[model samples]
Target: MLIYTGGTFGMVYDEDGSLAPFNFSLVIEKIPELQSLDLKLTVISFPDPVDSSNVDIEHWQAMAYIIKDHYEQYDAFVILHGTDTMAYTASALSFMFRGINKPIILTGAQIPIGATRSDARENLITALEIASTKNGKVPMLNEIAVYFNYYLLKGNRSQKIRSSNFAAFESENFPYLAESGVKIVFNESFMNTHDPQQKLEFYPKMDPNVVVLKIFPGITEEVVKSILNIKGLKGVVIESYGSGNIMSWRWMEELLRDAVSRGIFLYNVSQCMGGSVVQGRYETSKMLSDIGVISGHDITTEAALAKLMHLLGTERNVDIIKQKLNVSIRGELTVV
Candidate 1:
């Protein structure tokens, strides 16, 4: 099944020569190679496609519900998404569909499919190939993933690091699940393994009352206080300095402590692209740990925010949410 949620990958030139979303039902005409794959294809698109920047909880719920409703019918699923918030959606879906036994691949293009020099054709083709691949009678991939350029990255572990380059997404703290070249090479050791008896758990709810607070040098107390005090805020993903360190300012510590006291969950993730969060490795971050801030370990800021929203929406128990945050729920973070 191919789910189109609107992106550059589905765009083509209209009568006025303006870029517009083309009819995906006619995708076979655009890429006839799909016919050679010898697979039955079905396309479902959003009624009104929106840019990735505009994707919200409603869109996430729609995608999750669609997969859940069709879980028994499809062998695998492919999602065509915009590049901007692809990682966020991927991460959210990973958590929503825990213990999934089939592949759910998300791919998009940096350029429109209508352009002669576009990369959309290769991306979509490869994504479909990966989704359909199998190991004997079982699916080769059983988790949500992002296939871009030539690398297949675990959905929750991926981050969009480059805006203009073809290699836009990268898994800094994790290894690529597979790399496409002469042939797709699978890194089975790093791939997520699921229990055969584990049933898929669909979580349709995702609370958007979460905010990402990136710490910067010379940040003022007023700015920090206002963010932490946002009305109805349930969680905060703090993008801290090296090894999850923040300035050891008394005011900042008090603000964090007060936020914790007010039942706000603070999750600490490293600002660096390639490191884990060792909360107490330095004295600067020891205060955060002491204040009950959950360590995000090696999780990306995008994944951390998504996980926060998922937990806040599904679990009401604060302790359970904190426990899940410290562990890898869907391979989103590395414990060690």
Candidate 2:
């Protein structure tokens, strides 16, 4: 199954020369190589294409529902998404679909398919091949992943680090699952495998009452208070400095402590692209640990936020949510 969400990958030059989404019905005409793959193809597109920036909880739920409704029919699934929030979507889906026995590959392009120099054709083609590949009768990739610029990154581990470049996504803390060159090479040691007998579980609910607060030097108390005090806020993903350290400010500490007391889950994540959050490793971060702020370990801010929402939406117990936050529910973070 090929699912097309709005992105540069599906765009083409309109009659006036402006870029617009083209009909996927003619996708084979645009890229003739798909016919050579000799696989049954089915295309499902959003009713109205949406830019990635506009992606929200509703959009994520819709994607999850589509996969759940058709989980049995397809051997694998491919999602063409916008690069801007592709990592977030991938992360959310990874959590939503638990113990999935088949591959769910997400890919998009930096340029439109209509352009002569576009990278869309190769990205789409390779993503499909990887999704369909198997080890004997078992699927080669049993987890959600992002395939871009010749690298296949675990969905929850990926981050979009580049805006204008073809190599837009990276998995800083984890190794690539596979790499595409003359031939696709699988890094089986790093890739996730699942039991074929395990049934696929779909989590459709995701709470959006979460915010990402990135701490920086000289940030005022008012800014901190207003965010922590947001009405109905259930969770906050704090992007702290090196090793999850934040300035030892009395006001900030008091505010965080108060939020914890109010039952708002505080998750500490690292601001660095390539390191884990080691709360209490430094004196500054020791306050966070003392205040009951859960360490996010090596989870990306995108994945942290998505995981928070997923947990909050599904679990009613605060203690259970905190426990899940400290562990890797769907390989989104390292426990250590």
Candidate 3:
């Protein structure tokens, strides 16, 4: 069975007026190719499927609970999600499920499945195949993944880079785990990260009070202070410039130091889309290290924010949370 949590892939223009949600239980009828897979498939969906832009922690919990409820009945699960927040959802789920051993493939299309030029058919079919693959008498994929265009990426490592292109998602810090072509070439190096003896545990509490603060050349001190001053803010992702460089003004340093002193978890991530945060690698970023800013090594802003929310909600100690942020919990980052 599959889960279609509304996104552009499931949307269709109705004769009544605007775009209304469709029933995903009849997915096989919409794309008859699914029936040809020789698999027992079903679908469970939210009452009012939402856009990725509107996705929040509550929706994430709803999705997780749905999977938990039907964990034993389905061989594997496939999610049709909006590309915008797909990576964030994937990252959150990686943390939500502690010991996963079943495929949870998240996929969507740049065009609607009903549209004449839609790319949804191929993506959904390939995703289902990958989700159902077995190896040596057991399931092949046992981790969260994102399948789109023709690439299969580790869920936590993927980010949506394009709004209109068919290849709308990319894994910036890591390579694709598998690319579906004539054969699904599993990047054996990045596949099947499960131990048969381990048991799966679910943690669905994700706090959403984190904020991303991007540093610019002339970012004012008052602006920085105001952001850090947000009441009940559990975490802040400081998007630093260049190789994690930031303005070295005294006011900026004091504000950050004060925030850290107040026990707010501060993470430093590179503003550049492709590189890791390299605190103390240059003179400009020395203050970041001095002020105890945790480096968000090679993690995209989307993943960074999702990870913070996951950790904040699940972990209690602030210092321990900071240390775990530097570790690659589920391949979301490369810790320095």
Candidate 4:
């Protein structure tokens, strides 16, 4: 089954020349090439269009419930979504539908489907092909993934690295599952699979008591102090500099200690792409280790944020959440 969550791919020009969502029922008509493919296709769309930026816990819950309600009937699913927060939703879904054995591929276009030079048709076509891909009876891909610009990337490992280019997403910490070209190349050695016998677990919502802090040079004590002081905040994902380095100061140490003492889970991630966070490798980051900060170890900021919200939402104990964040769940981070 194919689900449309509303994006540029479903838009067309209105009578006044303004962009608007068109009837998704016309999808097969708009892209007639699907007629040649041998697959049973079903299209379902959200009642209202949602800009990816507006997606929140409720949207995630709704999406999970929708998929769960139809899980038994469909062989696989292709979700057409907006690109702006694709990584965020992908990461969240990876946690929401743990142990899901069916392929859940999320895809979107850089340009609208109605535009003269749109990239939607090829993306949608390839996504459907990948969803239907099978070795005998079991699908080749059984995890949540994002297919874009000829690359099939692990959803939690992806980040939106560009806005203007057709290649808008990349998997910096992990290799892609497959690449489309003259022939689709599957990286079999690097691919991950789900246990078909294991039951799928569903998490409908995430805890909203989380915040992300991006560290910058010369950040004032007042700024950090205010951020760490958010009312009832349980989790914080700190985007630190190279190798998770941050300013070393007594006040900063005191604040972090206070937060930990108050049972807040702290995680450190590198702002640089392809860089791993090693807590005690440098003088600046060594203090983080001393104060019990959890190392994110090469996780993207998007995944870090989602994992934090997921853990805090499902597991209440701060210590258990700290341990789980340090371990790999759904391949979001490299635990060292």
Candidate number with greatest lDDT: 2
Tens-digit per-residue lDDT, 1-336, candidate 3: 688898989966688656666787778888998888898888778888899899988989988999888888887999999988998899888888877888999999888877788999999999999988887667788899999999999888888889979998988778898999998888877786657897879888888899999987788988998999999987999998978999888898899999999988898888777878888899879888888888988988877888898899889987689888888887788866
Clashes of each: 0, 0, 1, 0
lDDT of 1 by residue, 301-322 (tens): 9999999999998999988999
lDDT of 1 at 335: 93
Candidate 4, residues 93-130: lDDT per residue as tens digits?
99988788888999999898888899999999999998
Which candidate do you rate higher for TM-score, 2 or 3?
2
Worst 10 residues of 1 by lDDT: 187-196
Score candidate 4 by lDDT.
Answer: 0.89
TM-score for every candidate vs. truth?
A: 0.98, 0.99, 0.96, 0.98
Off by over 4 Å in 4: none
Q: What would you estimate as the lDDT of candidate 3?
A: 0.87
* lDDT of every model, 2 decimals: 0.92, 0.93, 0.87, 0.89
By lDDT, the better pick of 2 and 4 is: 2
Once fitted onto the true fold, the runs of candidate 2 whose alpha carbons sit more than 4 angstroms away are none
Error of 1 at 186 (Å): 0.7
Pairs of colliding residues, candidate 2: none
